[model samples]
Target: MDEQRKKGLEKMNEVYGWEMPNIEGDPYFDLTVDHLFGSIWTRPGLSMRDKRLLTLAAVTAQGRQDLGEVQVNAALFNEEFTEEELKEVAIFLTQYVGFPLGSGLNGTVSKVVAKRRKAAEKGAGEDKRANVNAAVKMNTGTSLDDE
Candidate 1:
């Protein structure tokens, strides 16, 4: 196994407490890692930060909050994103995507941010409702036409 695969597997077991067995004996091992994660995902053109953003978007588009949360947490751990970044992603999702997906993603992102911020003893922040409303207005180009 190359160093990155070994390290990822080890970290998965240690931090996440899950053992990922080798699907194949040896030949496929390095190939699998290289093609899937290393070659494709680690392409030099896109910065790690941009990859994280696209990943979050793909997960959000798929409406897979569980997988999305896993990636989001990883991004945070890797310093690929911050709590504010998560919020902005969710806001963008709300604007172009549908409200349901947006809300669901926002909820998951909020929980992660809150937990992480609390762990870091950072000050709490406002809820996403305000941001959502603003996004709706922006997307619709409306002033509410208050009567």
Candidate 2:
């Protein structure tokens, strides 16, 4: 990766919670990281989460379920959206995007939601144990809800 694409890939992976795959020798993939992610996505006017939501809308409207898979997974893993809110967005998009396209996108979102929630719940349990251990050494009682 070139310097700019490397930095863009790192930041995007951080936000998405997964390393986006690079296509070796593909100029298009290079351009995606260099231009779309590095330049356009880093614009100060809109937050990353907001940009993901808008991208979801655009992808759904165009019936691009493949891209939707990545965006929805990013949104869920990043906690940019709650499951209910994501479902609501799908329903809302039905009018503008049509039922077939919106429903297609929602199917991908639902799959990612389940997977992300399962991983998060497991991590939460481990985190609670660590917090409890720390609190014990400090002689301070900590409630799970306090976090």
Candidate 3:
């Protein structure tokens, strides 16, 4: 892999809490990994937590629960946001984004929390923080539209 692509893949994995493989040849994946993640995400102005909040809000406002779920799961897995904080985000967003969209986000938050809890329970013997990738994959699934 080229330097940018390698960097993108690592950033993508860190952001999403997944172990995404490098899939060459597809223009969409290539651009996503090389440009969006490599060039944009790695920029120094914003912290990862800040970027995640913006992304979560944007996706929630657009009624993209699938994407929102991914963000929520990542945030939780990475410990960027506590469960209570995520619940608060849903409530805070509901006011500006309207009840329907906010309600959807609230629901997404609940689902992600429950899934994480369940996974933690299932792997009671394992260290949840150490198995971030497995928990994230089980909860969010793999997707190309991560951003």
- Per-prediction tally of clashes: 0, 0, 0
lDDT of 2 by residue, 1-147 (tens): 678877777766665565455445556656666777777777799887788889989989999786776677667667898778888889999889899998987798787666657768887522334323332222224333454
Off by over 4 Å in 3: 124-147
- Report the C-alpha displacement of residue 130, candidate 2, in angstroms: 29
* lDDT over C-alpha atoms for residue 90 of model 1: 89
CA shift of 18, model 2, Å: 1.4
lDDT of 2: 0.70
User: Which stretches of model 2 miss by more than 4 angstroms?
Assistant: 21-24, 117-147
Q: Model 1 segments beyond 4 Å from truth?
A: 2-32, 117-147
Residue range 38-96, candidate 1, lDDT tens digits: 45565569776787788778878889887676666666656677877887888888887
lDDT of 3 by residue, 60-80 (tens): 999988788888988987899
TM-score, cand. 1? 0.60
What is the lDDT of every predicted structure here?
Answer: 0.61, 0.70, 0.81
lDDT of 3: 0.81
Q: Which candidate tops lDDT?
A: 3
**lDDT score at residue 90, model 3, on the 0-100 scale:** 90
